[model samples]
Target: MNENQKLALVTGANKGIGRAAADQLAALGMTVLIGARDARRGEEAAAAVRAEGGDAYAIVLDVTDPATIEEAARWIEGSYGRLDVLINNAGITGSGRVSPAEAIDQIPSTVDLDMVRAVFETNVFGVIAVTNAMLPLLRRSPAPRIVNVSSGGGSLAIASDPDGPFTGLPTSAAYSPSKTALNALTVQYANELRKEGFLINAAAPGYVATDINNHSGFLTPAQGATVLVRLATLDADGPTAGFFSADGPVPW
Candidate 1:
């Protein structure tokens, strides 16, 4: 990689919003590392990006697997020496469908503890593991940025309000709570790293049509990725310790 070119790693980049984010980042002149748990899927996604004239490579990284996370960190260090941007886009919604009726599987009243653990394992704890593993490499960069993909459903401000848009959506104990935890985690990281010239923030990509929701969402993956790409390529003066969507700052 060129000394001047930025290297970005997007977790869960084999499909959906993560894939779109990788493509967009590469188009912006950044060498994007597509992190996916599955090797074949990662390679296929990377090849597609390259076909579109983007600098992208597949990197086998499963956020839920510490061994893979550690290996990915070492590989990145050996390859590029430093990471300019880190997009924690890998996540899971726990169950197949999240409609009002289907959401019962994740309802707090009788949700399986294992299901909650599994959800947090990927959505929350996985991000922590990956971020910590990549910290050293990120420290080497003159300007490092981290974007944690969150969700509007996790917003307590909106959820607490009676007439909020999220009120109509089904209640979730696994996915929603995990994202809320992620938002809190994002703030803590940004607060700790702000002095070091790191722009760390959470992005709530409005409901996008993807496998996570069975394609029930209205927005396309590309539309959902816009905020992620924006947050990943922020200027030095860009906001940190904040939650944002494409529209603007998301309520806490």
Candidate 2:
């Protein structure tokens, strides 16, 4: 890596919006690290980005595994010295999710506890592990940013009201609540680091058609990634401790 080049890492970058964010960040002249759980898929994605002339590489990073997160952080610090951006995009919607055409049976009343724990393991705790592991490297950068990829369904206000935009949405203690926790985590970190030239925020990618949703979404991965990429590369004057969607700020 060149001394003048910026470094960014996007978790779950082997596919979906994570891959799109990695590609977009690389296009903007950052040396993007694709953090994927599977080595083969990660390498393939990195190869694809290289074929497209982007400075991108894959690293095995399973967010749910603290060891992997720590190892990845150490690797980044050793390889590039600092991390300009960290996009926590690795997440799972839980095994209970199905197509929109079907009824969501995994409501809070009957949701499995193990499923919820599994969801939080990736969507919430995993983010905390990776962020904490990467903070040292992030602080080394002149300008650092953290973007937590959240979901619109995580909005408690929208989910609680019958007349709200997200009314009739599936009740998910596992997925939705995990994202809500992520949003809160974003604010807490922003408040702690904002004065130190770090900008931390949460971004909702709208309903992007990825494997998480079983392709029920209308937007493409690239389109969904725009807001996340935007947040990840925020200027000094950009807003922090906020939740945003492609359209605008999301109500918490």
Candidate 3:
């Protein structure tokens, strides 16, 4: 690994959007670290990338596990010495979906309290944990970028609108709120890191077909990963502390 070669980390990259993001990053000539909770899945994904002629490797990374996060950081520090980009793509939808209609009331009122806690534990707190743990390594790079994978469901404008796509959608008090909090955190971190020349942004990869939704989405994983890869490889002068979609800025 030369000093000039960039290194990136993508969380929950065993498959779907996260895997797509890792593959794209590797295609862009970066050494991508595929973070997955299951070691075998991570290695398999990494092997697939290598078979496709991309530079990628696997790491055991359960976002909720602080020990695993620390271990990953130590491995990166020892092997690469610096981390140029980090895509926090790992997240969970939480429980409460029997059906779309039933999900509506279930999410806000009848949802299990433990489910909400678990959602926040992985989506919100886990991000903070990984970022803080890797900040030192990121600072070592000349140009560092952080792309937080958020969701359109978290957009206040859409969620609050009367005629919007998410207007009448189920009130995902747990998942939606966690993503919203992630967007807020992205802004705060970007603001603080701006003076240090780090570009940090939150992006919503429009509804994509993946296991998370039981393959009901209209878009593909590649479509969702496009915006993420773009943001992850942003130029030094690119926008920071902002929310964006495939087309452009998403309403906060």
Give the number of the best model, judged by TM-score: 1
| Arranged by TM-score, best first | 1, 3, 2
Higher-scoring candidate on lDDT, 1 or 2: 1
lDDT of 2 by residue, 1-252 (tens): 698898999999999999999889888888999999999999999999989999999999999887888889888878888899999999987774533234265577987889889999988999999999999999999889999999887788777888976566666667778888999999999999998999999999988888866778899999999999999888899999999999989989
Order of candidate numbers by lDDT, starting with the best: 1, 3, 2
Q: How much is 201 displaced in model 3, in angstroms?
A: 0.5
State the weakest 10-residue window (summed lDDT) of model 2.
Answer: 96-105
Give the CA lDDT, 0 to 100, for residue 10 in model 3: 96
* Pairs of residues at least 3 apart in sequence or in different chains that clash in candidate 1: none
Span of 10 residues, lowest total lDDT, candidate 3: 96-105
- Cα RMSD for candidate 2? 1.4
lDDT-superior candidate, 2 or 3 = 3
Indicate which candidate wins on lDDT. 1
> Between candidates 1 and 2, which one is better according to TM-score?
1
For model 2, what is the error of residue 41's alpha carbon versus the real structure, in angstroms, after optimal superposition? 0.3
Candidate 1, 99-206: lDDT as tens digits: 444576887888888999999999999999999999999999998999999998789998778898766656788988998999999999999999999999999989
RMSD of each: 1.1, 1.4, 1.6
Q: Can you write out model 3's per-residue Cα lDDT over 16-116, one digit (the tens) per residue? A: 89999998998989999999999999999999999999989999999999999999999999998899999999998875331243455346777788888
Clashing pairs in 3: none
